[model samples]
Target: MTATSRSLSFALKSATVRSSSGHFLRELLANEHLPQDELQARQDHAARAIAEQAMQESPFYRRLYGERGIDPRILDDPRRWAELPILDRATVKAHSGEFATPEAVGRGVRTALTGGSTGEPLRTLHDARVPSLALAWRMYSWWGIQPYDDLARIGRWSFGRMDAVKNTIAWWPTRQLSLDAAVISEETMTEFHRAVTRVRPRLLEGYVGALLELADFLERRGLRIPGPTAVATTAAPLTAPVRARLEDAFEAPVHDEYRGSEFGWMAGECDRQDGLHIFSDVRRIEVVDADGRPAPPGEEGDLVITDLRNRVFPMLRYRNGDRGILRERSCPCGRSLPLMEPPQGRTIDVLHLPSGASLAHRLTALFSAHPESVRLFQIHQQADASLTIRVVPGPGERSRRHVEDAVEDLRTRIRHEVPVRIEYVESLPYTGGKTKYILSDLPAVVPQAPTPPPDTPSVRA
Candidate 1:
């Protein structure tokens, strides 16, 4: 074999060694070849097992099932699984402790605190060497990344002992490098760019917004770092414009990953770049309509998920708070795993009306007509039921009329006099160095609000 071929062969072997028991890796390889009906049967069996265990072990779930009069066996029936109550982030946060079973805790599962884009901290527990990590490794493998290959990640640093230890160990075998996304300036970007140059990672992963900002800075400074084989973005939506820009700046293909802190690596883009393939062996994903019915293929709905492997804290039919469409057909890549549209954003960001109604993905529609005038926008809802429309206007008075027109259009679409006010600025302020599209300063928002939207919306030219 050629020297390059020999190096790849060695790396694959190292990856196999690093995947703990390699149980998940082996299962993932097998499941990919399984027919759709067989795959669904496996997921159904796993789901029923998780539900039964949750009712038996978890205090929170046991009490919830008892109160709702839901038999744990309902999950055993494919049709009845939809009848079980849905759990959201607030419910999980409130009863997080009860979600952890004595057996799981005694067996020493790892707990992770994920604040996400909402800035609300959520703590969850899983096995120390969770199957989700193996799923992630498999996804990376699709992008030609082995577990021991170099990966440069840009995100906030975790100071926990476990995080530190994992980082230290991952670096040795994989050369994992991390750059802080929380701090960004000319000096910091220059340093981060330099680090990427030295590491020369095979894969780059992190928040799309942060990378886009860094890419912009690098392009302006005429500093061209060699592109990695692939760039994967999580924690935020990988909008088309941002994806194109990142690909241009880094000279690499950008792929989107759909996952959350509650569950790691639910689905990911394949080499086809068509839609994300569900990690069906580990998690069962569903797109449900308002009445909690399964949405037809190619129709958008709320994303509900069930964790098949997280026995400690069963996340069955858990509302992911994101909206996406379920694709009707199989992927051209020939992977038996199902497909779904990349999430638009969180469900909380959907404008809620008191008339037993809510609107999804409508926030961007208000400014669509005023593309040239608006540079960026943020919608902030106040406690007193007033709306603050924050806008970063583009240069020149020619665009001012369009901005005003857009605000008027928003008021009309809202169909309510909620006291809309427009605030113009050079740029919208970011919390923890990240910009949010929709923010609520209302005191009763968190733990009460249903759908909180993500960071600031990008301007259309």
Candidate 2:
């Protein structure tokens, strides 16, 4: 066989083996018939297995455990697992090499970059086993999507060339229905609608902004794509207003997923939609107070995650830069995983007004107001309350009139009279470190421009 064919075969076999093993583990943990204590026992066993793997293979963890003077065997207790120090994007980026397993890095495994929402991009590496476990866990718990299911697909709306190679390859195994969200033209939107109608995949997934754009198009034109079994939104936070609009248009139960490039799947919305279910099996999640100690349940703190699945590249106690509260009450859905309140906007998202009051969630409504002409845009708030809006027009003029109209719409929605300067840049700047689209920026709070992550590089408009 050709080298390409051999590589494909090896990847498929590895995915299959990992999937099988992961399914067996998931089934053991997700046994609804078992008592609560029994399920907890199984969960503890799984956590220990993952912890042991990390302790053995990961260089970062080996150093960490050595420094802490704690044996990996002592991680048998779930409570002790929480005591491990939390990590953040800065730490991961600063010490990327130390985190990876020597063998995996030497063999040239797949590397991915995260477009951090806060403009801090993180470069991450993963073996096929990492994504394999993620896919298996997702299938077993969330949608039960099998490898053979044609309907198991991914919908991506991104604007980076680095992703093109990986995305193209991934599409071969699982059908990928792609929509070029970078430039949302009339033709692109029409093509997107057509593709969605044709695919009719069981699961629909994409960024919150892109999905909402499609939903708005469908709603405005009185058009509807064939309904999928489930609609999953990620990459961007899903506000209640956007979620309501997407659910109404798609006619499917909407679920939110919280993940990072450094770490695979950290938390996701359960069927109940009450709160995000933390995947304690593959990772340890901590809600820490300002003092860096573990916050009590029902208290708000920064989210730090330690990814146990990625031994090749460990993400120990990685801070996600998201603030959320951990709810103490058990979810009605009956999953043993802990619940976290839907994360509010990121720290960089806060708009500090001249009056001293901070504004969040206001910009979402402003952007969503003009769905047809304006496809994607970013807002930067100056210290004096003057705002700079970078916009990508749908199919219309980027003239002063268009700017004024958008600004008027924003004023009406926000009920604040702030001077609006519209800059029709080619594209909004991405945080240099990551590929995520930043919706709002306060110049005062964030003095320096954020850099996009290396993998998912950004362009300046």
Highest-scoring model, lDDT: 1
Over 4 Å off, model 1 = 1-21, 116-119, 157-166, 346-461
lDDT of 1: 0.70
Instruction: Tell me each candidate's TM-score.
Output: 0.71, 0.64
Q: Alpha carbon lDDT of residue 382, candidate 2? A: 65
TM-score of 1: 0.71
lDDT of 1 by residue, 249-356 (tens): 777878888877678779999887778998888888888888889889888888898888887777778876677788879998888999888886642343334332
Q: Measured by C-alpha RMSD in angstroms, how accurate is candidate 1? A: 14.4
Cα distance off (Å), candidate 1, residue 423: 19
- Among all candidates shown, the one with the greatest TM-score: 1
Predicted structure 2: lDDT: 0.60
lDDT of candidates 1 onward, in order = 0.70, 0.60
The segments of candidate 2 whose C-alpha lies over 4 angstroms from its true place after superposition are 1-59, 62-78, 105-108, 131-174, 346-461
